[model samples]
Target: MKIQIEKEKLQAAYKNACGCVKDAFEKLFGEDVLETAKPTLDDYKTIKSYEDACDVLGLSPILSENRNKALCAQFPDHYDFRQNMPKHIIALMKLEIISRALWGKSFEPEPDAEGNKIYWYPWFALYTKDEVDRMSDEERKSLCGALFGGAGHGAYAGFGYLTADGRSSDSGADIGIRLCQETEEKAAYFGRQFIELWAEYLAYGFKVTEHLK
Candidate 1:
């Protein structure tokens, strides 16, 4: 059977999902959870001035500049100014969070031949197949939580802090929040109570109640 989710219900679901993630994050990292990473504008200034912000901050100044130019060329006003800047800012913040969480964590290379460490982005590559194979199930769960939880925080921050028109932080936040909620679900599936609830309340099915006018 199909289930319909009204606007209020959807909002409630979103809130519940966010709460689950926040709770899990607190349990893992302790009381000062969101404070684990704070964003800085130094990278923004550097990128605006055409410096190598990418090396330290995982942001490509050249790409960002090109994006700005393209956006200006297309939207020319508040559209460009409001949208891209917030997304980039949030991306940098997320990178910082990931970097801090991953520091000193053991992540080996692939192929058992190349000794190079894995690159942090794309998230899936956080652990190689071999590395995962070597880990106990509990260890694997912790790694999964670290990866998803950290990313979820970044996405959550983006959603909470950034405001933009189309393709706003909601996109990333939805993915991050869902992944985080799934962590709890996976724990439950394994007969553990790592988290109290599903990140999302509407996991079964939900249909839009109305279209935005």
Candidate 2:
């Protein structure tokens, strides 16, 4: 709900999270992708708290119903309500979760990290599927191109490692999930922690200011 954390602390935490995601990306893919993606505090800070971050980037509250309709019409063979859907929709959803974890909430599992009740954002599940029978090859290829640009291959392929279902993975679709998870989780953890640490830092700043007064 309401964040009691200080702004400066949150900012620092968010930055650290971004760095972690960036590092992961560099490790899995290469520095080239990170250089192009260039995820930053300003890009993530727009998403306020964990919940808001989750809803906006994780779930993608931005694209309206009309947009979906248009996408479906334009790519009829690839866009299937029952199957393919739009790639952007899925991308937005994954982004929201990453944002939530980094900016809004902490990663908490019921029993701990190894628990079955490990609640993950939606995109993690989506990328694990086999062929989207609903969409045509052209549609899938186009969606991949649009979402990933030049860095799509390695990122998409990396999802096979992240997901449980390795055999049924799509390179284009999985890359979005991999990148989002890498970025958002770090941002959320650091943002919340930074706030707590900043409170102490501010107390010292206040004392110094008060002495001057």
Candidate 3:
């Protein structure tokens, strides 16, 4: 459940994965939708590590907290921006939705899917249908939960809407399993592979798949 891998590999791999998703996004969605995510990929150049990612996700929690009323009395300026989620975060959100769409599962989100403060946990579990179907729910939970122990900046472990509470109304494994494989498109291969490699590494480190029932 612990890791010693260099943050550089994770940083590079995440950007590559984002790039691949962006390519798919352009093909499936439109340039307008793609605009939100474009800046995030470029952000990788300077925001190059787990700590950096945490900071980025922490952009303005107040805007989203307490039904857009967290510490609002102190900062009236954020009132406008807090009306909706930040554009870049929405872009990342769309990326995840697109991953689900590839599997014929559509998402009509309504402030669901608590944002990942750690970033990687959301995308790191990307897996082809066969690849993830091979994993049981508990296995998937452990793998995604591997990073739960990370501290600071209000970081929590596990993927899905579950992070907001003790239970997962959405299935993390369902999201993890549905990816490129469903499309049968060649472009999906590398993206899927990059995700797969990191998944295996995390699984190894966390021992999630070592003893599956």
Candidate 3: stretches off by over 4 Å: 1-84, 105-213
Better of 1 and 3 by TM-score: 1
Enumerate clash totals for all models, in the order shown. 1, 17, 0
In candidate 1, how many Å is residue 120 off? 16
Query: Which residues of candidate 1, in runs, are more than 4 Å off?
Result: 1-124, 149-213
- 84-201: candidate 2 lDDT, tens digit per residue: 4454444444343544445334432222222223222222112223444567899788767755585434344232333354443323344333223334455344334233222232
Candidate with better lDDT, 1 vs 3: 3
Predicted structure 3, TM vs. truth:
0.19
Q: What is the lDDT of candidate 2?
A: 0.40
User: Total clashes, candidate 1?
Assistant: 1
Give one digit per residue, the lDDT tens place, for model 3 in 95-170: 3433333322232222326553322233333345676679999987875576454422233332444444446665
Q: Tell me each candidate's RMSD, in Å, in order.
A: 20.8, 22.9, 17.2
Judged by lDDT against the true structure, how good is candidate 3?
0.40
> TM-scores of the models, in the given order?
0.19, 0.18, 0.19
Model 1 lDDT tens row, 34-76 = 3422323332212211122234344433333345554455445
Q: List the residue pairs that clash in candidate 3.
A: none
